[model samples]
Target chain A: MGIAYPIAKVKGESADRIYGVKGFPSAALVDASGRVIWSGHPSSVPRGEIEKALEGTAFLPRLEGKAYKKVDKLIVSREYGKAHAEVLKGLQKDSADETLQGAQVSIEALLEKMQGAANAAVEGQDFGVALDTYSQIEKLFKGHEAAKLAKADAKAVEKNPAAKDEIAAWKKMVKADETQFEGDFEKAGKLYAAIAKKYPETKSGERAQAFLSRHHM
Target chain B: MKLLGLALALGAVLSGPRAAKVEVGDLAPEIYGEWYLSDASSLEEVRGRVILLDFWRTW
Candidate 1:
């Protein structure tokens, strides 16, 4: 059946692995900000819940007891970035809750780790890795002072001509893969060939060349 | 006494740590895979729009 809404195939069993979805017909209503406002069997998700979440007025349950337990698991797994976001969303529901104070400490530690990695990459002259790590920090911690600094650092790395060209070529390769996934073989083939022609020495270009040759293009 | 032990065991299994059940107020995990009938896209690509994620499989 054709779908009017945007749809994506979950990579491998990622849905099951990441979201704990155990069966088919599962669904989640994620807000524009990427936070899931409701999740369960599709039919159990109310239309009003979706509307309220979109309006930023949905009543969120307190993050205590069971919810705190859930957050703790994420912390132990070192999914601190996710834990921080989840805790922040919980704070929005109940800003005065004292349990969230503990969560904040873990979030701070994770941010420090991320910053350390970015700094080390810069010291090693791995501008691309530094830029990527900083961009991730900016996205995950938007509006934070650290995220602001990350954006600045990423821009500085991009200022280097070699780094800029490398990033540009990598983006084109990603676009080519996207095109192939969309089932436009002809367009994808041409994009791949272009990368192979223009950036033959790069890893992505080498991959493109291999794909074209294997596919007899 | 045996029934009480079984009940406790079941409770532990049910409440034990597992992948957190995604629910309201949690961030949607990024989804990546092959696209069907459209250009490959991502949640970040459609950040401003309301998304209805339809999870289906053709058996």
Candidate 2:
């Protein structure tokens, strides 16, 4: 049976855990802003609720009405830079458009999401990841708040006493991941084991252990 | 506002692994679908659209 409306078959319980779905065949209605509006079994969802919730929300990336297919597609492609440019053009025409404003906010949210990761890495004492993620944000999101935050975080990481070793291990982990992605599991496995052993208490080390165990290496 | 779950965009690294038992008012968690059964690959692809996330088990 063919179904429409963006249904997906999730692989793990990550979604299930996040949504707190305690049973099978459950559902949740999510709004344009990624918030849960309503949730229940399919048949039990409120009659006019869907309409009301989706009323001002657009089917496009971050708009209120009408799908901006072209720009939306760029966003779908993760071309945030290009998508941001396109949104700026739209703003030129309709400076007060809620949709364009929403799009800009969404872009910021995405960048902020990345910044959150960097922050999390710092919390986890994963200096390598904190530095790497922050550096990437500094480069890609030059003008955004995420970029600003990343700059501060990166500086902090550089100041940490043990950053050098952690960063070196992370670089090696990056190489190992590249090798694994390139289909050299054998070498990658060895590399992971080595990193895990060398950086035993760090985030990269834990990740290496998780990877090895997950892959049965 | 958007339904974006940007993954590894910066330097193609990796991102959040999120959330808890969310009730009606909580912000929905990002989806991690190993397989996409629709035209969309990521949540961002279907942004701005209302989503009905059906959590089920293949008995």
Candidate 3:
């Protein structure tokens, strides 16, 4: 097992210059022959999976037709952009019930496993496995509080017809995240300010206020 | 006794970092409970695979 820290680089810099920035604890597994078999977030991917990834024996689960259908429906619905809030509300309710079930299990069990496995793989400097683990963490997060917030945000947008333009502007702001894109934060700040001005009581306005404060030039 | 110490050490390692985003090197936090795959298999069954779990609001 091996441990590797995450690298945070600007547009131009050596890949090795990761200083001060915090990294999530992720692990990777390596085989006897020094090959990566598995890797994932330090908290969730089981140690056993890391071993498998390191051994080149990791079995990627096949998504079934039903899951595909559900995802397709979600995508289609999101594109139309109506009823999204209600949809998110329903999904949040369902997810809440499922999350309650997970409480019975030991979260530490999975976290330890993934960490051990990642530790093994990082020894090989196999970043592909590292990236895969990050993806897994992204997936695992859907069942979390942030997912609920996302759902609520969607529902809120659905409730107010007048907020459509504001929501679109907010979406653009998110898409232009500094790490992801070189977005004009100044424009986003203006949009957020406008949304706040229009709907003083709305969460969108509140979020916009925060955005303006955080990304102020 | 050594095994117990190792177990404790692992426990500390497991609970170490908390980050908002799931980065490559960060620990994956337990967002919720048992996640079931489309195959009707419990998430526990695929403990070793990197999973891309996405939550979408269906309209």
Candidate 4:
């Protein structure tokens, strides 16, 4: 009953002031700007509205402030490469702007986090996670410092003699993720089991191990 | 005396932040309290997300 992100809970009276709630089980669907896009019981929120809001909604906010006003549009749309190039150009002209600096810092940190996790996966013999993580970073940060580093990391993983076999076994991991997200538990479970059986001693395998233990699949 | 105290408590609750009315399409007011079950410490961390603030109580 979980999604890709963590659910946050807050116990406070602040909920009372949000439109002065009228009854028990009041729910409000807010967009990124905190506007009440929908309000009512959870059941009443339209499914299409949720899907529409979810489009291009990544975990990170677009870099804030108007310091790089032109690039702001690009980042919001997830045109990272164009934004990256624009930010670089902005940084050259005015190096002191926090908003301009944010673009570099945020993406670099994200890259570092992924690259570090990939390295750990490789060390733990989870070649599937290692390759997938590196591949994503290599693609995601195409015009950033992380792209080169992820490529180098991918090459390092490829050097391992067991890398090919282990990575091949875990190839369906993405499909498992998609199925799980789609709520196709039976299919996802089978995919996970297949991956786990193929790459028995890795982190990717442990996904199936954990899923089965939790769901009794 | 007990009834007086209850009246005063209700008055205080009604006079608090809940005094403002919230309508659809209006910007939501700040929400905060003891947070749990999340990696993000503040709403700012989840800025890009569509947040559903649920108000519930244990029956």
Please report the candidate that would top lDDT against the real structure: 2
Top DockQ model = 2
Fnat values, one per model, are 0.41, 0.53, 0.01, 0.48
Give i-RMS (Å) per prediction.
Answer: 16.2, 11.9, 17.1, 16.6
Candidate 4 residue lDDT tens string, B8-47: 0011122353333445544454444444555565555555
For candidate 4, lDDT tens digit of each residue in A25-118?
6677666544557778766867776666665243334665555567877765555656777887888898987777877676556556667788
Error of 4 at A149 (Å): 3.5
Whole-model Cα lDDT of every candidate shown, in order: 0.59, 0.64, 0.34, 0.60
DockQ of each: 0.17, 0.24, 0.03, 0.19
Which of the predicted structures, 1 or 4, would earn the higher DockQ when compared with the native?
A: 4
Model 3: per-residue Cα lDDT over A11-92, one tens digit each: 2111111111222333443332222233444456465654444344222122235523443344332221212233345456
What's the TM-score of every candidate structure? 0.42, 0.48, 0.25, 0.52
Give one digit per residue, the lDDT tens place, for model 1 in B1-59.
Answer: 00000000000112234433343443455565654444335656554335556455443
Please give the lDDT score at residue A22 for candidate 4: 65
Judged by DockQ relative to the true structure, which candidate is superior, 2 or 4?
A: 2
Query: Which runs in model 3 stand beyond 4 Å of their true positions?
Result: A1-3, A8-183, A215-217, B1-59
